[model samples]
Target: MQTAQTVMMVRPAAFRANPETMKSNHFQKSWDGDLDVASLARKAFDDYAASLRAEGVEVRIIDDISSQETPDSLFPNNWIVMLADGSIFTFPMEAHNRRRERRMDIIADLSHDYEVLRRVDLSRYEDKNLYLEGTGSLILDHDNRIAYACRSSRSSEVVGREFERLSGYRIHWFDARDRLHHPIYHTNVMMSIGTRFAIVCLESLSSESERRELISQLERTGKNLIDVTFAQMEAFSCNVLELRN
Candidate 1:
């Protein structure tokens, strides 16, 4: 689906800066010692969901269970993705605690609104320490059947190939890094695909060849590439998602 009228958001119970994910996630800010980070996160989540609901968007708010200890539970996009064909694919997460964020009950609840044709489980890759963080790992151009991914420890060629084999999406893989030359954790944080436009941090791509190839592919797929700088990427400008009302 190029645009979705409905979205599911998890209201975090124990939301805080996750130490396990901090090494890879440069975008996450460390919680200050004086502030109640969990409380702040909960308030932000509630307000965000409320704002979406007020905008006439159908927001499915699921409360995260405190006992789960999943600090990044609010980011449901990392664990599960639903395709237009009604296939719900579950992915393997690099962080063990993040893996616990996946809830079968939530998938069951989605059946009330969506026609789930099949459930594809790719979590088996976790046993081999190979992971693909769902939509976060892949910036998919649904109209073109192209899956653009920035190769990272959390997202590798092995699982990317498997995703292509299962979803029939051709993988356009590239190596992207931050200004510090550290690998970008998730593709979604620096690339986004919409029907008419693509937000991408071409500067983050390490190679000129890869940048040229990505631009060529995006143009061929009829997307106007809105190239962003590394600084803008760090500010989360490329992390935009499209929603249709």
Candidate 2:
């Protein structure tokens, strides 16, 4: 399936901006005041899960371990991805602390409902300084068997190729930059691929050739392209996921 009928979410016990991720993830911002960020985050998470459940979407909530000190545990997609083929792939994270977010118990929990055929652990590449932060680095076009990725420290070409070989998906690798000309930390930050539609910031691509190729492929695969400006992309217009109800 291109989209999932069920989704999993992590409820944070100590939600705060991660200092390690702040180096490359420009979208993250540190709080200025003594706000109870964790409380606010919990409230938002509950509201989001409630809304999804109201829409008939099966939402699985996992409480984050308070003693783990994993500030970014809320984003489970960055560490592990469950594929339609009953395979789970664990990716290497750019931030050292984020690696701690991976837990076998979560996989075991998911296996109760879903048939997990196999587990692929690519985290070993971290020892070589190569990283691929799961769905963050890849915007997968499952219908077309394509994996779109932007080259960044968090998304290495070596790992992308490895994923391509393992997952049997064609990798369309490209370079994408923010308005400040720095490489976009994640592919999902500037583009998203739905079943029959795609939201993309074409201007973020480094070269016009890459943009043309991307557009051509999307069109070929019957995607209705929705191009967003740099401002809209920075506002997270492209950071969206379409799930089956």
Candidate 3:
């Protein structure tokens, strides 16, 4: 029933400033070696917006808070999720660079029209070395009240479990691996679930039991499967969101 009429995406200001992943984290950037980040990001911004528009979705394009120099602002799901009930969640991110992306000004701008409810600020957990990077760490099955997550430093089992308890979502979990044979950092970068369909790269799941569970859950929920290869996943195929459509 979510016809996702309006969606938002941030134009990447510092395309190559994702220093957390490049410097601190284990995740590798595919185009880091020889890519003109600003140029590539601009094209990607256009293309991403076009793709969403092609689906008849209205896009709310916001240039990232460049003055703040917040990298990874291109992926906005971390900082906010405007809910059907008009509530907004301000999530906590594990990466220090990402944590800086949250700004009250953006939230305040959004509150002009939407009914503002409680702000669930989870940043306190970060002080304890616990974190949950919003939709990046948890792909919400909003209709079913489920949150599918892969345990990582960004998405701790403890945190995901607590979210299940708080949000009343059943946790569909798995331990997945990337090409380098390391666990993928964020869950949303690997798989996405929707009401009518599911787009996933089953090959990324190295364990048979884990893969089976992920597939079975989708199938049981009556979803049409669109399986992609790990190559496609690397292309951000898993990053595709089935908006309110």
Which candidate number maximizes lDDT?
A: 2
* TM-scores for the candidates: 0.96, 0.98, 0.87
Residue pairs clashing, model 1:
none
Model 3 has a clash total of 2
lDDT of each: 0.90, 0.92, 0.76
Arrange candidates, best lDDT first. Answer: 2, 1, 3
Candidate 2, poorest ten consecutive residues by summed lDDT: 107-116
Prediction RMSDs, each to the true structure = 1.2, 0.9, 2.5
Off by over 4 Å in 3: 23-27, 30-35, 50-55
Superposition error at 212 for model 3 (Å)? 2.0
- lDDT (Cα, 0-100) at 31 in candidate 2: 95
| Per-residue lDDT over 1-245 for candidate 1, one digit per residue giving the tens place of the 0 to 100 score | 58888998998999887999998988788756898888988898889888888888889889999999999998899999999988899999999999899898999998777899989999999999999998899988888889999989899799989889999889999999999999999999889999899999998987999999999999998898899998899889999888877
Candidate 2, 1-245: lDDT as tens digits: 68998989999988899999888988889998988999999999999999999998999999999899999999899999988898899999988888989998998888887898989999999999999999999998887789999999999899988898899888899999998898899999999999889999999997999999999999999999999999999899999899888
Q: Residue 238 of candidate 1: its Cα lDDT?
A: 96
Q: How much is the lDDT of residue 230 in candidate 1?
A: 88
Clashing pairs in 2: none
> The CA-based lDDT of model 1 is what?
0.90
